[model samples]
Target: MSRVPFYLLVGVLLVAGIAVTIYRHVAFEVPWVPGEQRQVWEVEAQVNFIAEGESAKVNLALPSNQEGFRILTENTGSSGFGLSFLDDDKGRRAQWATREAKGSQQLYYSVQLLVAPNAAQPRVEPPPPDQDVSWARPYDTAAKEVIDQAYRRSSDAFTFSRELARAFSGDRQDENARLLLTQFDRPTLLVKLLNQAGVSARKIHGLLLEDGRRRQSLTTWIQVFDADNDWVIINPTSGEQGRPDNLLLWEAGDQAALEVQGGRDSKVTFSMLQHNEPASVAVRNQLANDTLLNFSIHSLPLEEQSLFKTILLIPIGALVVVLLRVLIGIKTSGTFMPVLIALAFIQTTLFTGLAGFLLVVAVGLVIRNYLSYLNLLLVARVSAVIITVIAIISIFSVVAYRMGLNAGLTITFFPMIILSWTIERMSILWEEEGPKEVLIQGGGSLLTAVLAYLAMNNPWIRHITFNFLGVQLILMAFILLLGNYTGYRLLELRRFKPITED
Candidate 1:
């Protein structure tokens, strides 16, 4: 067949594939009306009551800031004695009693409150009395040095806050936050620890939202105001307990409350079922009905909604591989080798998986090259190379296991035939055009593989491929455009530069 006809046929097939994918993913009927708005406030309570048989008053404090929420109505079950809502000077209160049960009886209630637009204050228990008594700050010279290194690297409030939070938490949880903390001072860690122990603390961000210009970036530490000590400014992230004038307090709370919103609206519904059966059995039964409410795109603008729908374009990656091979004269061992490799990289991550793949390929190539000295026929030579590649992979797995490289398992996904064919091509080039030519071609193939891996594994690409059906149409258009490019490639242009000069 003529190269033109072959290219045309491949282009037609690619256009068809893109069309189907777009129809499957991108095309969606978004309503003219705005998206729905949903706000969820998850409240969990753990109550402990200590009684010595006398009718003692039990007081539970509610959040003081009553700006946005209102207790609409409350329903009481038969298990509790008397319930009363008390209004306190600082915050709201709810009072209830229990009839003397010999052992311990627990009561649970969920209060449904209307959510307001503004922020809500998180409720926190008062700190122990000993918290006010300042003891000599504990000494840890190593930790102090680490903190200094962190501060020197980062001066941003977010960085300082993250570091301070990490140091205070003793680097137990919050891996992302810990990464941020490793750049600051010991005082930051101590302050973060104090905040975690029920003291109000935070790293505040200051910016000129109105002016659109750079504003003063200051890190001020402020303690929460209590009955004894007024709000004290302490630089915890700085490793200094005493106040620093550079720190600014935007707002103070026991703990930070984060509220995420989007331009488009969304809502989530939750239902709970309780049975008299054993807790474990009930949990098992509930697992069957468990549904996850994913609200990722609820807040995006309408113009961006179409972008969110392009997730169906994953199959286009296959078309891209095919086009690269037939139209662009790229040589891959197997028909679907590049696509399969790309998909594998998607699962294993590009950098780590590509490194493992290259390592395996290198080892396989070495073995194949050594075996070439045996002077076997083409089929036998290819087969022997495959076996050698497999054996090399097995050894790699063993070594990886001993060294604790978990990524070693990805070697199984390496196409044996592809490796064998690559070795054969490289050997042919080595004999004909020399090692330089072989290396150049090998480098080109590896570069294309890396590009394919990156394009296929991109988050935006995945999102478009999985979400929207119309993206396939866009892909079809791209394929059609690339199909008409009859001009020489950038490499071909260089090769024909002498002729062009004439």
Candidate 2:
């Protein structure tokens, strides 16, 4: 074989692995380290209303154009009612309907949001003209006076809105603000005052998120459009200029946060809980919604994902076997047998696995030695060995259970067919090469299996192999490189040591 083509293939594998790993880490935001956790908030909204005997309908506003957070999952809990989501120029809303309702009804909308700094931002639009800003009687005069006072000290829309907010925030409130305050709350009043001065603004409702909070209501804030056609959030109470990190915008625009038809006394209350989740979990959840990436492992059902998590570690064990057998000249009964044994070890811990393996194989060898006297055909003899192996496992498992050795029950995790084959190979080795050679190969197999178990069971290795698909390519490259190596094994180098000593 041309070494050039071989080297080129290895180079391609290495490069491709590294490039893909980097891409997944950067593009998909998959973490490099295991057990890294990100803070996530689970926010649930409870919509309660009293419906009469007639048909009833409810519309609840939902969060959209989130900042500093991404919604990973959203679901509703509305039993016995028809539910549908509506999106329009107004905003996103969830509507529920039921005919002939006669009692208090409750509906739920819950969302899991991942905290991320680079979360998507809403498009910037100039604020719509205020069509409903007119105030009646003395309140109309008071609003005009308040807007004129703030406009005189400010240059643009943002500063004008800030000045108006500042005017009513502190102890030395403007007389006009005090008069307006009697008729309107601070946020609603600010929106009216800003619009009266020809500065585009509106009142937005948001939730102040805190860990483990329940039954919290919305906090109203002023949203003003700046000269650049971007929405600038202002704290109407504190006169703050930007949105706070803890604030979640739940409702915007000039629409009611909730509306109920054929129902009365309707209200929505929010409950939120915050916790940490592994970065891999967050990536899985975030990507689960993307249709194009549905073919990836993260998109699999949870049961299949968990199965693949274990399955992906097999390559690591195979790499360990290749290194032990090819580079260290370790002898084993079968080439990939150590890998299967290592997988069992993962399920049954190191010391317990070692004990169970020895007990099974030692007893199996004795049984095979006796069966050989029957002179059975090869296929029938191997079939007998498999049945014998299963019988041994069952007997041992029951005995262990009776004795309360729960760990021993895990011995069943060992592959039965593989164990039978191993016994068959070892028996043939014993007959052909004698007991001494059999011991060497059997001991080598156990040692290789132990080493492979250590590699496959490592937390970092398991995490990387599961999260990064590129690692499989890297492992394949390494196994191929080891396969091509014809150099002296580490044990063989001992022969050269004697020559150098002389």
lDDT digits (tens) for residues 167-246 of candidate 2: 99788497788888888888887877777677788888899999999999998888898667787899988888999999
- Off-target runs (Cα >4 Å) in candidate 1 are 1-314, 318-336, 500-502
Q: Candidate 2, which ten residues in sequence have the lowest lDDT sum?
A: 287-296
**lDDT value, candidate 1, whole model:** 0.47
Off by over 4 Å in 2: 1-38, 48-53, 72-80, 101-107, 122-164, 167-201, 212-214, 225-230, 275-296, 370-381, 398-406, 481-486
Residue-wise C-alpha lDDT for candidate 1, range 1-502, written one tens digit per residue = 4578756766776666565544332222111122222222322222334344544334344433233332322333325446676664333445556555333433333433323324233444433333442323233344444445456654543344444434455443344334434654444444544443334443432111112222223233434334433343344443344333212122233222111121111111122221123211211221112222212242456556545433343456656764675456565544555565665676566776677677767776677677778888988988887887788778887888889987877666666667667777777777778877776666656656666777766665664454433455557656655766676554555677888999
Q: Tell me how far the alpha carbon of residue 197 in candidate 2 is from the true structure, in angstroms, after superposition.
A: 7.8
Evaluate model 2: give its lDDT.
Answer: 0.87
TM-score result, candidate 2: 0.81
In model 2, the clashing pairs are none
> Which structure among the candidates has the greatest TM-score?
2
lDDT of each: 0.47, 0.87
Candidate 1 residue-wise lDDT at 334: 46
